[model samples]
Target: MTQPQGALLVGSIAFDDAERTMRTAATELGGLLRRIPDGEVGPRFHWIMFQPDVLGQAEGIERVGEERIPLRMLDARPLRVADGVDPREIRFPELGYARAARESYALFRRLREEGVIAPGMRFQVSLPTPLAVVGAFFPPEQRAAIEPAYREAMSREVEEILAAVPHEDLAVQWDLAVEFQIIEELPGGVAAWWDGAWAGVVERAAWGVDLVPHDVEVGLHLCYGDVAEKHFVEPRDAGNLVRFANAIADAARRVPAWVHLPVPIERDDDAFFSPLADLRLPEETELYLGLVHREDGAEGAQRRIAAAQRVVPRFGVATECGIGRAPAGTTEGILRTHAEVAAPW
Candidate 1:
């Protein structure tokens, strides 16, 4: 079960909530995670995990800040569930959430200092993207203003996280579910907004990147909704590829970091990657392809791995999205299957 050289696998524990509790994440995917590479024993691996202490609840508008703080004093607005306010805007006390991030950073620092990771391991820390914060509250029309707000907030968050982790040992991944926020909107508005926001993030990162120590890994995990209902976030249509391509290309060119993406889940469209491969990205930027489907069985997984090998050689293996919604046992099978399929390649 030891990982072979250049063995590609999914990143670490993905949780269902923003708080990123480890036990919660472990319970959600531990069985399978424990089984992979003979229960976490194998291969030069890539892991994705959340810093729990840094998180607030995804519930009521104000999930940020210390749990001890009263919501009313913290800018948290009260509303009836039926009142129709968007769920994310309920802000918690800014100071509390900010402190929480600091405390969480300590925990991550401690774990690293204690050598929680094995030798030769590279890990990626994931946080909610700036767009995620704003989109969670605003409607399509209001989303335009979120970019500026998120940029300032996110830039600070990124800077703090980079300071906390060892620059050389780990990588950072900004989870961008918000980029797909306007999937249901007219393509023109959605595309324009995302393009602008993507640019803003890159600009913010210019300073944020320097905060990380030299040689620290930085990446962007771009996926549409991983939830069961929302399925694919962007249009899978022929014309839709152009916009997506632009977004990916722009992010790559601007950020110059690894870009991990989910495979197109709705159809068997290998061609969807045609635009991606052609993107003007650095040769050093790695592409982690989500080759194994959460719902795929042994046969389906084999097909997926084989198909992907045809396009990219240095590609890594991962799930289409986090397995938070799936039963832990099912997710375990996926991890194991990914190892099996990639063993020969």
Candidate 2:
């Protein structure tokens, strides 16, 4: 059976012990990762949600849930704005990528020297799009106002990571789940974050990528939102992902190292992948289809890979989103499926 040439991890592997996490991934999937994440070991359960709540201060911000709830909220009060908050001062809290990446990179170095990790792999740092954070918690009217400050803060985190990690050994991925809302027109519920067409979205999207230096690899993880392990809206096809990725490629000053698009588990048909034939990415920019699912493992990945090959002659493999929120004890099987379905790098 044919398989992709390489593989990619879209950040957040599932493990509580940081050292154990690095060792496991480096041992099992070293050949697949061009970069490695810290297993998101701490409080990043939903990836980027918890980090931003502490970035900029909102005077009236209050949590709606008392203890625990599936959906957390900031009590969307209409006519309310984050006006008192200085967006310029927004900074992601303690688990910032700079410190986190450094720690993971040190462990990765040790593992590589011990011959557990593949040589020359960089540390992969994943970040949420500013709009993803703004749209999720901020009021609609304030999202635009709040985005600039938050975007800059994210850049600061990236700058710190670059400063701490070697450029030759670093790769950055922008977690772009919310951008799909604009592409899908936010069918089930109107999202407060996006109000512009594809062009404006592209312009904003370019801002995120441009922050990374040319030498460091930059990639975009285009997603349909993974909340409680379900999409905000399952894609009917890959059309919107293709459209959005092309727009970003044209708009950004530099080409991305790769572009990753999700494949809903049920979408192993030609229709779901045919839009990839229209993808106009630069040759150096790799395409990674998120086709590996924990549910059916290698067999499911193979079916999706077969369908994708008809349109995309070359590509890599990943899950629809990070496996951080996946069921416990399923991580190794999912990791193995990626390696099993794709040719090792």
- Maximum-TM-score candidate: 2
Task: Please report the candidate that would top lDDT against the real structure.
Answer: 2
The backbone clash count of each candidate, in order, is: 14, 0
- Candidate 1, 14: how far from true, in Å? 6.3
Clashes of 1: 14
- Local distance difference test, each candidate: 0.45, 0.78
lDDT of 2 by residue, 1-345 (tens): 467988888888788866777788777777777877777767565576565345433444344334433324422222224447564544434436567777877887787798777778777788887777767666666677667756776777788888888899888899887777776777654354544667666887898899889999999999887777789899889998998899999989999999999999998899888888889999999889999988889998899998999888889999999998889899898888888888876
> Per-residue error at 18 for model 1, in Å?
13
Where is model 2 poorest over a 10-residue stretch in terms of lDDT?
Answer: 71-80
Q: How far in Å is the alpha carbon of 3 misplaced in model 2?
A: 1.9
